[model samples]
Target: MNKRNFLVTGASLAAVALLSTACSTTGGASGDPAAQRAAIDSAVESSLARLFQENSNAKELVASAKGVLVFPNFVSAGFIVGGASGTGALRKGGKSTAHFRMTEASVGLLAGAQSQGVFILFMTQEALNSFEASRGWTAGVDGSITFVNVGAGVNVSTQTAQQPIIGFALTNGGLMGNLSLNGSKISPLTFN
Candidate 1:
């Protein structure tokens, strides 16, 4: 190849790399901690309102919430079929501290990562005890927790909801893989 052509190609590759790096860093810092919290709060409020308007169960879900925690980013993965989850939280504030985590295995043409998801940990002594005490709890098995899809408008009414549960609405980060293979990891909770 000619010297001029080689130089142009090199510059083009460099530009592409720089652009890729920038896009990868888009959600970094998410902004000031306080601002992010407020952002989460606002997003949750708006999302829940929309959910409530569309689904009566969502209204009851909000009514049933004592306290809510909107993670705005919960990561997941499988293999071929993968997507991120992002949303808000609902909880009743009375505990000194709270902790929760979820891990899953899936089959089918599954692959990639759910890099963004919201985990609503219902803050209550009863729920806390159940989660902490149990070794494992599936989404629709042991408890009455509900997950609101970013697009799917669905919820369980408080009258039907056995116990107050935390709710989450994940909105961003759909392309992701496993943490061990792709260096992804779960983020910890941020208190107010």
Candidate 2:
């Protein structure tokens, strides 16, 4: 196929994949407030455990964070017009205080699907309150978010961890580099 044809075909396929996945995943249990909350809770627990295992210092970060938003299973699939969506919980004092959903759309040179976990730690009470107060929060636009890269034997010091907001993207499957939250928007999910 020609270059133009190839690009068009790829974009079409990606859109189809994204729509199908969203429809299937966002239906039934996802529509159920209780079920969705349970899923998000489970995801947050598992993601936190993994983070703690990778870097013990994360435990301290979590403990100190005023609130943490954990999206355990964020799935992103795209060709050129890519989009991602996931549900997560906001935890304070080790308890889920609210639920939220993160969504983003992008148009660029990209393809394939990826499943990953994302954790955003609000290090300050002000930051946490701002996020909660916002009707819709867009990362990188609404507020500056620093991405934390944790490697072997690496530690996040108290000073370094003092950022107002810190984000971690954990790749679980598929392409890792293809996922990002630059334009992602997070909003509260009402369960009723």
Candidate 3:
């Protein structure tokens, strides 16, 4: 086989493997529902604490927001073709109102795997209501989510805080860089 063809084939196989793994483990639907909820809750709490510690601006944004949707462990892996999936809980008034799962697929020159925590804040009641009422909410299609780059020593701008919907991606080291929520689908999860 030609070198280019061989490289393409290998990358395709790797992408498929990564996608299947993401589907199987995201949200842990195969396991007990209560346990899954508990795990997600714990992760969410820890992630929030970390966010607040890293960026003081986050606490204010979260406090004023109508609801917070947190995905503590969002995994993305790709070698050319790539996909990402994660489960999260929607919190209203500091309580878990419901659980949701998010998934996205892309085709581009991308390679690597990353696990990070993602937070989406609904700054307006209308935005939060529309999300909750939808059967399935897509990031760009349902509503635009403005992803903020809240890295160390960087403060969120007042304009970003005023947006109807805002998002942040956090890693163990600190905030992640260049997050995109476009074309991602979020669906309500009902545990059996």
1 or 2, greater by lDDT: 2
Where is the poorest 10-residue window by lDDT in model 2?
Answer: 172-181
Off by over 4 Å in 3: 1-6, 26-30
Give lDDT tens digits, candidate 1, residues 1-192.
999878655654554443344322213436565554455555445545554454465455545555454443344443332333332333344222332333333334643444444435453557655544555444555555544433344433344354445444433432121222122122333533
Write down the RMSD of all candidates, one decimal each: 10.0, 3.3, 2.2
Candidate 3 C-alpha lDDT tens digits along 1-192:
999989977997898787677756635544788887887787889889999888888888999999999998888888888888888899999999898888888888889988889999999999999999999999999999898977767888899988999998997778874898899999987666
Give one digit per residue, the lDDT tens place, for model 2 in 3-120: 9989787787767677567624532466777786777687789888887776676788889899999887777778877777888889999989998888877778877877688888
Q: Give all candidates' CA lDDT scores.
A: 0.43, 0.77, 0.87
How many collisions between residues are there in candidate 1?
36
**TM-scores of the models, in the order given:** 0.44, 0.85, 0.90
Top-scoring candidate (lDDT) = 3
After superposing candidate 2, which stretches have Cα over 4 Å from the reference? 1-10, 16-20, 23-31, 157-159, 173-180
What is candidate 3's local distance difference test score? 0.87
